[model samples]
Target: MRCEIPILLRCCFCFPLRYGLLVWAYLKQISSISFSTVMIIKLCHDYYRIQASGAVISSLIILLMILDIAFNVLFIISAHKKDYKKMRIFYRYSIAVLCLNVAIVGFCIAMYAYYVYVAPIMIIFIWSFMVPTLVMIIVMVFLQGYLIILVRSEFIKLKNNSQFEFVNHGADEKCTANLDFVKEIPGTV
Candidate 1:
């Protein structure tokens, strides 16, 4: 089923067995560069300094992605199971949480962008590596929540529409059946 694919991908992302292999490749590439080359030296220095933290952030993002995927899978399954009432409630809560997340991400990104581009004239700490990393982490967190909410809301809307259609169809069928029965009866008039 289409729902199961997301779950499998979620498991893979959570464990990150594939990501580990990608990191290993990057490490090998770094190691292969000759140290005697000046460009290689600069590259190695920047790579080691920035990429150490980047790896941690990337791992966290991947984990959150897995969670997002899992939530989507669950939402799809729940909707398919005819759990419309619960799905609607879940969707409303998800929207609220996602809106909060979007606000936080927007604030963090704005602050970080200003710090990077404009804050140098006004503040010293804003330029620090830690601030940017923290902002990035917050952004990733918000993004994951936002994605989950989007998927859940979409599924909820679709399921609700389908439920309405099903009910309407049943009613139409019953009406037609009643008309057929009435016609078949002996005329008393």
Candidate 2:
């Protein structure tokens, strides 16, 4: 049996079931909305650290967060309806989001590298302005990766604990599927 993570909060604080996943989804949705809003507002004010071009970058980040919210909503619906397959869709979506987060962090690091090597900027300016933003994105990427693991654990637990009816996918040579007999007859004979 696959080892399961019982709790989402620091690995040992919360419900032992998929409820942790429900809390995780809600927390992610709220944080994404609030963080995106705060980033937009900050971008508007901090014209030195972030310029008009930063608006486009921040918009792209916001768009990704919005997509995350949509997936969380779908996850909520799936869990409420006990649709484990749809829940698995959210698992796959989380993996994709983690990849996106990694890409964003890589792009940000590359931009910093360009500022350092290709066109040297004031060390103080880059350190004071760009460093914080890069750090924030990197932290988000790590958090996303951690959440992916937590969600995966929950999925594994669900798959293991749940009962499923097994079906034979073989050729119905005797048309056993079509048989609707009035009496219980031995099909083997």
Candidate 3:
């Protein structure tokens, strides 16, 4: 996660590496591209935001997305400062994202069922609606689930590495050895 390798670091680099690329893509597109131009890269991302704006989990999804941006920044800073301990904040939200993505998958399956029931024959209108949405949701579900697993594995690995102080006295140690302590972060929330 950091150059020259900070003292504290991720046991599984893929989590941060994946999100780093996502954050970079978000920044690059949002800064330099017009909405129309951005669509080429952000097709599914924009579709999720716009289409799900009124869905039941929209608020949570929006909150998680916004929070993810913030967390990615935090991860960058913490990684630079050699504070993997602080990165533990992602443990909860990663699971939430995974669950929400599964919910979306369920909703898409239901949508498909209704569409097939209404029209056993091919329908362009519903095809247009279902194909992209289903594809996007399915992809998100897999990605989110893998991310959840990666985050959990990283935290579990952290639990024993005393170099990061992941182990502490009188701790519950459920998921992350009860990551109940946070070293103060400079210019961080």
Candidate 4:
């Protein structure tokens, strides 16, 4: 049971699940916006602007998240192919994505926190959803850090082993073709 815990945690923190949850969270927020909510936005000048801005901002953020998810999927493919350079690039990009997300979510949370005091009703839709999503993202970022370390170590190990094997077996002349290119050239011969 103790040994199974890490595997369980890994599954929970996997890219598919994380990406799905993020999509679900965003969709939930979008779906909750009803006709009444639109009417309220039109009734109040301040809310109309805020709602429009938030809508645009969230849409951009969601697009970024989708791109991040696509990059992660590519990263997984590169890892499987043992392409170390691609893995490095993709992994670095993943970290950048995570940082950008942290910044975006943190800023939104701070805004929500301020609004919580200033306008409780204004924050109602976001507080419960965004808070938990932020926590999950934070956890995923940490998990990704650990995964990056593991990938780096594995890549290094694989590289060294390949080098060692090459040094041991790659030097045997008998194991390779004995024909010299110079001798094989008809005119030169």
- Using TM-score as the measure, which candidate wins? 2
Clash number for each model? 0, 0, 1, 0
Report the C-alpha lDDT of model 1 over 1-189, residue by residue, as the tens digit. 355213122212453322332343244334333322444345456665667677566555445544444444444455456455545655665566567566766776677677667656544665575567666767756655544544454454556567664245565654334334555668788
Tens-place lDDT digits, model 4, residues 16-114: 433333343344335344433554454454544567677666555555545655565555555556666766676577577667767867886788788
By TM-score, how accurate is candidate 3?
0.51
Residue 96 C-alpha lDDT in model 4: 78
lDDT of 3 by residue, 29-132 (tens): 35433433443445445555666545434445445455666665665554345454755776576677678778877887887787688876755677887888
Q: Is candidate 3 or candidate 4 better by TM-score?
A: 3
* Runs off by more than 4 Å, candidate 4: 1-62, 120-126, 165-189
lDDT of 2 by residue, 1-189 (tens): 898645343333546546766777788779878997887787677857776787778878778777877888998887677676877899899788778778877887887887788767555577886778778878878877777777666666566657657777675456536656677666885
TM-score of each: 0.33, 0.64, 0.51, 0.47
lDDT of 1: 0.50
lDDT minimum window of 10 residues, candidate 3: 5-14
Candidate 4, position 79, lDDT? 52
Give the better candidate number (1 or 3) by lDDT.
Answer: 3
